[model samples]
Target chain A: MSLYIKYPKYLTAGESCVVVEFADEIDRGANDAVMNLKKYLLTQKDISIVECLPTYRSLAVYFDPTVVSADEVINAAKSAPELDGEECASSFTEISIPVCYGGEYGPDIANVAEHAGISEEDVIKRHSSKSCHCYMIGFMPGFAYLGGMDESIATPRLTNPRTVINGGSVGIAGKQTGIYPIDSPGGWQLIGRTPLRLFTPEASRPTLIEAGYEVRFVPVAEEEYKKIEAEVAAGTYKPLITEAK
Target chain B: MELIIRKAGMLTSVQDLGRWGYQSSGVPVAGAMDLPALRIGNVMLGNPEGAAALEVTLLGPEIEVKGTGAAVFAGADLGFSVNGKAVGSWRSVVLKDGDVITFKGPRGKGCRGNLCFAGGVYIPPVMNSCSTYIRAKIGGVEGRALKIGDVIKIGEPAALWKKLEGFCLPEDLDPAQDANAPLAIITGLQEDAFTEEGKKLLFESEYTITAESDRMGCRLEGAKIEHTEKGADIVSDAIPLGAVQIPGHGMPIIMLADRQTTGGYTKIGVLTPLSMEALVQKMPGSKVRFRRADVSEGVAEQMRIKEAVRRAKELRLSHVSRTHSEAPKPLFGHFILTVEGKRYEITCEEI
Candidate 1:
């Protein structure tokens, strides 16, 4: 068992905002500290905290300094309750997203496969096998930073980011994988595309997934992918859901 | 009860106090950049503080009133004419059906125009705010800028025959040349990250708002600010209102009403609330200078302003009650009244 150590470092983010750093660098443990603290602080019913946005290694706490002072926040953080060990042990959920790899759906899949010295089939199988954790949300609305990937599949970011990565396009960069919720600029190495509507403004919950959700990928034929896209456009596509423990 | 934009200006959109409480989902707090002026305009019309108003940039479009109405225009003098006849600003004026309202080029640069109808502008509130957010493509009228052929409905006036004389801002109280006004700032969390020289330069230098500025942030171009040492690629953290974040390049970016919830950068200072509202209204290329103020002074000033606003509201209420029963016939009773010791004169018409 890895013993939890309080990562040292605190920096003022803005005039009133404070960031409590959990580690000197990014890692799954650091990510856990942020998530755990976020969950803990959010449960404080009376605290007028504005927001708690978690990142790879820290949870940025925003509050109305007028209502609650920065010193109070620091005190609360130092004595924050310990996280339940079981919560961390809950394996990332198994979510299968049907992806059309290669060709128009995934123009960069073959390139990624070649770069990893693996066959196209091996890339798809390795990618779909393990569930990934939703570390945080940023860069764009509903765009999740997911962790957990077979080390063999890791690759460097592109020299030049694409001017536009369509919504629902799944890509990998370094040790991370993510899905584009909206069409925006990106630099991730695209390996495949999902037909899921990751973000839909008309939906009650616009973002298809949230931080802490698990994700899985499943290979599909191009024709099936096109059909799914059509359903999404028609507002008839329903994400395959599994009850999480 | 309705108005149509016969001619769309450079940019016209519906706004309110702001879309608060929804920053977590990455929603921008889009609202009138000139909030004080917006509030005063609403108060003049006896409308609620959160009433939707129209914010016209630089030049206002020609508007055709479709129904009987009266409205108050506030903020910078956007050159105004009714049927080609020049009129005074900061006062209520009756509009006849088919009356043409046009705003020529602004009298001066860095001026925005606000039109508050006797009745609030009727637009569906998205996420509890009428403010327009162009980026997220949500809120306001279809979550977009006002365009030609858009028919804006108006609600019933809160008070008929109400005069708008005393509530308008007197000429002198208006910031003399608001656009170029030096913004007073309070040092922020990352001020210590920069070298003493960099810190000195921040207050001494003049920065120009770049054309790239928007509701998200106002990017400044000036001497590059440098830190005492190289900084690490920081994990994202919460950002506060008016926080000035300087990334690696040294260009200071002042966050505005629609800024993101979190960011990663070395912050140098934060604009005081009073100055932030004024600075955000400035157009691109407007000159900017920063001055330092301590946090205690900043907080005290905010409290003073808040008390002043409260007093203004109470005085307006008292004036309303005083005029309602014991009455007057001055075509309008226009006099600045004192609230919380700050004075605000108003004009009221009792039929």
Candidate 2:
């Protein structure tokens, strides 16, 4: 049976901001509360909120300091609807991203495979078979924190961080798996690569995957990876997005 | 109009009144560190407050004019000269093509120059402002610093430029010498999070600006204020300009124009808007003292200062229209400078 835990009472973040916390302690339930609260707050259009940033277990709502007071934010937040259980269970969209496992694209894949006590092929198959939920966006814009990776492929982060991880590089750190949005420094263990551009400033919605979206991986050959990367760079690669069924 | 950089001073960048309305997207509100001086310099050349100007650091720059121009130097009275002849500050001077403008030396605290043109600098607005933010790579030269050989375009002179005279001035064109004036601060939302002793330390004790001060925030070194609830960890929250935030290490960092939109530190107080201009002008190594003030006091102070500035503008408008009816045309070009040990150049044009 699942247990329901409410967060601490909401408090004024600033003169115009309010933080409605679900829990101070970090846990799966706390994370769920934050996600639910964020989804619920997104539906409340009259709140005059400028931005809503959700973290591991809390959400910060930024409003115009001149327009709304802290007291008003508190009242509005309290009046917001409670989260429904069914929506939480089935709101994510599963997406299959093609990845090229091992070799230069994933230098640490052998290490991860050895640590997981499994063959490299088994590791690739297992990683490609699971559907993961997008938990949050952070570190840089458009980078999503995906939950629900296959336990067989779980690995800790590298002792040293890579100076540059190219965009679309698929990496796993501990239990969290994600893709690099831009060329940035990271400590995640790279197990594969993708041709998808997770973030592009020129795109209408820069972030292709939003929080709560589901993700799946499909293995591709190294040469195929190269072709896809070239096509994406040339602006001709069409992403395989499945239509709503 | 055009100007060539003779010498690029240390940390010189193109600025305006500061970029606003996009702070939510994490873009900084970058502009002049000393805003009053920048505004006056623009106003003197008949440019609006938001006109692009040059933010010159302690070290001045050097440049040569390419066309007729008129510009005024304001703030900190940095020693300035044109073609070996010392120039008077807070006044408009016309420059002919081929004339060299240079900063001779640093004269006082927080030196800046607003070389306004008749039509203002015409740099394309990136994210709605010409202000440069070096980090996060947004605004100004593809979100980068001005390097050597960058050619900046000057705006066309205003249509009503002929009606303006020389640079505007206050009836009392004198500096207020009260270096020890108490900074009025309104207790912030996290005021109660600080100990009473911390409040006393903030208001009573003195602090000096560290060399780490920049457009981001002012790092102060002095008495360490105590936080209440000893080990309480607070989540990050939205921070505004003039906020005095105390991080885990206990020193107070006053947020400035380019500060982050959100911070995890505890903000004990926020400076009154009336004091922000004055505070910005305080040079490095300058001592600052804070004084507790209620919200009403802050509001009243803001009202008084706004009224004073409004009256000053009106008087200057009348004086300019009556005296010199023609725009003080300058020979367009850039001004060069050398401050302390750094070297840089800034563009100058006639408004």
Candidate 3:
């Protein structure tokens, strides 16, 4: 692992926000930089930062222009503690998501396997092999942008996207993989379905997984998936959040 | 104070400033599109600028007042009437328990109107706001539009400045009114992604707001801005207020209050706050142009509006003091005054 030493660009977004762009391309280190800046920025009380949006490669710091100046916010963002490769790998609540792949759950699993020149079983194995880092949660509520997809299973998105993809559907787009927290029209190649509710609007914490967390998929049988779904609907299903050792 | 919905119009929902501070999890700032109008409506009634109000679309709601209170109809005049008698817009008026508020006749200059009460609309704040994000099913009146027979509870006005009826905001100060000048834009966010001709067309050509335009975004039909080989897609990033995103189709879509947290399109520019106010008022099929502007212009306009709202509140307070013959309430504040990097704590107390 190498230390993140690249300087960031401060792009002004209208009069209300300033985007601290760490990288133009999606870089893991840049995403970490964004998360670190956001984590540090929230602790400061001097700047009247109304809100913050941490993306894959940038962090948009929102504030009321009537109260704080862009220059001041830029200064505050600049002062965020820089991290080395080791410190950047800070402790994260590793969220283990149980997924049921193939058949009705993942309609495009076969398509993805054919496109990648691999078997459907190999596709699932590769997808669940590594722990994908959650870069940012966006699009729909609780939709997580999970990076670190295995290049062997990398596939392009479906040309004709479905009108409505079910919530908790895991999919892949180009080199990136993500979860559709809610039902939405999407182009990503469907691979699996998770029973856990990513977005519980009525719950105290609206979103289950957040940015800067890690998500690992554990393949479950159809019966187990059905059992978990019932438990979730009953409000008795607790997501397995284990410490990453 | 309480209100009952006699007839819920096309689209009427409770809205405050916005659901602020939460965007990372994909929550949008769903509030009144005509924010200035909403703010002024609240201000005229001696309510805080961000107090919850009923944002009515072209066709306004018919409400049966069940409790006596003060209310003001601001923004696009939706032909507000009480007991079938027409009333003026932008003025604070007393609402009796029996008063029936209705929207009759043709629509006004703007698309939306804000019906504000002296005391804010008393709805539980979801994520610290009453603004309704219908798509997310969060915030305001059960996170949905007010339907027939829905009860609306009103909160008590701030003790410092209670509702003072008869305070009318001058037409000149109304933010719902459009400016003669073109919309101002802080240009060139992803300037490289667009050709020079594309950039010029953005400032020169007239854009017609399409029918698809709503709170989430205003889709525009205009000159096709040429995209570079890089195409329109970029790593998804935060969608700023008034972000002019030119997609692969070469047309521009201006992101608004209910836009998603982040987007992948190339944003060529961000519209100034004043431009946003003016743009929201323009009905579908109306034309709009953009002019180059800097941050200072926006800041100046914001300060101007803030000062006006502050003065209006003070003026109404003065009138209340004169009528009641009461001493002003106690006020206290603590401020950190920084001069040339040197910090100083400043405190002021009204004794």
Q: Which ten residues in a row have the lowest lDDT in candidate 1 chain A?
A: A1-10
Q: TM-scores, in order shown?
A: 0.83, 0.72, 0.89
| Candidates, DockQ | 0.27, 0.16, 0.69
Supply candidate 2's per-residue lDDT for B282.
73
Q: Which candidate leads in DockQ?
A: 3
The lDDT for every candidate, in the order shown, is 0.72, 0.68, 0.84
After the best TM-score superposition of candidate 1, give how far the Cα of residue A86 lies from its true spot, in angstroms. 4.5
Residue A116 in candidate 2, Cα distance off native in Å: 5.1
Candidate 1, residue B123: the lDDT equals: 84
Worst 10-residue stretch by lDDT in candidate 3 chain B?
B323-332
Give per-residue CA lDDT, model 3, range B10-78, as digits (tens). Answer: 999999999877788788888988887888788777688999999988888889988778888987777
Ranking by lDDT: 3, 1, 2
RMSD of each: 5.8, 9.1, 5.8
The runs of at least 3 residues in candidate 1 whose Cα sits more than 4 Å from the true structure, single-residue gaps closed, are: A1-20, A49-51, A60-79, A91-96, A156-164, A185-187, A223-227, A230-237, A241-245, B80-90, B159-166, B169-182, B315-351
By TM-score, the best candidate is 3
Worst 10 residues of 2 chain A by lDDT: A1-10
> TM-score-based ranking, best first?
3, 1, 2
Question: Model 2, range A94-155, lDDT digits (tens) per residue?
Answer: 67788998888888898789989999898898888887776556545567767788887889
